[model samples]
Target: MNIDTIAKMLFFATVRIENHGAKSASVGTGFIMTASLENGDQCPMLVTNKHVLAGAQQLVAHFIPRKPEANVPDLGQAVAVDLPPTMYVGHPDPTVDIAVMPLAPTLLLLANKLFIQALPLSLLATELPDLYTDAIEEITFVGYPNGHRDPMNFTPIARRGITATPLQLDFGGKPMFLVDGSVFGGSSGSPVFLFNQGTYRSGPNVITAGSRIALVGIIAQTMLRNAQLPVAEEVAATAHVKFAQELNIGIAFNAKAIKESIELMVSSAGQHLATAATGDGVTELSPA
Candidate 1:
């Protein structure tokens, strides 16, 4: 598959986790990465923003596949699915916004059963060229907004945007690309990709060129302007009417931080796999 196709697959893995009981909501996106199992065998792992899964006792991921043939029924329905029992969360580093979830054979099988294709783990280490080298780089962001339900309405919407700055900046110490596109509260964990300029298969598999997409960074936070008041009542008591301006904001993340998190997860997962391989009769599976 080409970059666009791969991007869609990445979006499918992105999920919206809700915790009404906890009175909080967050957005998270994940992609398959390679890791080792207890038997010292390598397996696929899921990686996403740490904040997305923070403090949740339960989690569910919704995946939407490329639409079926024109004759197929339910052409645009969103598909709701769950990760497998073998999935395990890696130690989270709050400093950086990332987390790794190890996937067991059962999870891979479950993904296969659901017809959700996992992106090649090799892409994690592939170096993305600096967007600064070019005046503009075409990109796309994918994620679930507002804990929305699934076929998330005919596959995740691919929003097109261009990098606005020649040089990228660190967002809270994570790699980030400044784009002209507007993202909202629920877009925190969206994966931003550089469009690949290449060919693709025809039909429902139509792959557009000049659209090579690379996982450059994950959406973390958007910059906003707010009045600094000692208290809400202070501004109100000063004889000023309550009003605020909503301006176009900026999104940021530390590129190096994200890279480090991914590397740590990959490295730690390998060790876990080796430990599992010893087979002392200890189950590595985390209870769902």
Candidate 2:
């Protein structure tokens, strides 16, 4: 597919995620991905940031009603599906901040009514030649900023930007990179895409890279600068300072991390399945 077509397809994989705490409610963005095994097995997973799910007693995923494509041109209502604890599978390392949840049950419920798509495992950097990540290119992400959606299509907003930092290099001592894009609270889990639009440089060599779309990383957090400089305790104790604005510097964990986490998920899923096959009522899935 062409770049535009591929972008539209990726949206089907991106969905609105809601994390409901016992007393408060919050929302974030996430996307879907598919992993294929050597044994000819394919697994569907839902991914998002770990912090987005923090303190959440319950989780709900919202999908745009597309498959049942509205008969009229006007916009329609969205479907909100509550997710059980057993439905989500998070990364073993709490520090990783990436979670994977099975999407089969969700797809079954939707009955193919939602026009969502899953990202192929081939789009992962770890699964591809190192040349892709070695090249610096433009990137984009779709997400709900401040819990806002299109309302018309019930889709998240698409934000485009370039890589402020190199993909293969670590940012601030972490396995992530800096993105020169505006990031908000609701964008915590947005997947960072590295889809080329035209010719770009590949390290010291130049190449005509076009229509190449791969998920290089996922937005983890954003950088913030103190709008009001902090004063010494002796000068102004308990001083109230002005709020800070988004630096538009986003932190995206390398997609390699996701690939590593997926391995853990595959193994755990096998064990979970074995237990389920025995009707043991044992499920080893939970949010980190």
How many backbone overlaps does candidate 1 show?
25
Leading candidate by lDDT: 2
lDDT of 1 by residue, 1-288 (tens): 222344435545454444222665455555555544456566665666666666765566654433343222232454455544224453355555666666564365454333344443323313433222244556567765443434425344456676665325443343555666766666666666654545422224444344333455666655556654444675467644434433444363434445566556656645543321222111112111
After TM-score superposition, the amount by which residue 175's alpha carbon in candidate 2 deviates from its true location, in angstroms, is 1.7
Model 2 vs truth, CA RMSD: 8.6
Candidate 2 residue runs with Cα over 4 Å from true position: 1-4, 68-75, 133-136, 229-242, 271-288
Query: Which model scores highest in TM-score?
Result: 2
How high is each candidate's TM-score? 0.63, 0.81
Error of 2 at 197 (Å): 2.1
> Candidate 1 — worst ten consecutive residues by lDDT sum?
279-288
Give me candidate 1's TM-score against the actual structure: 0.63
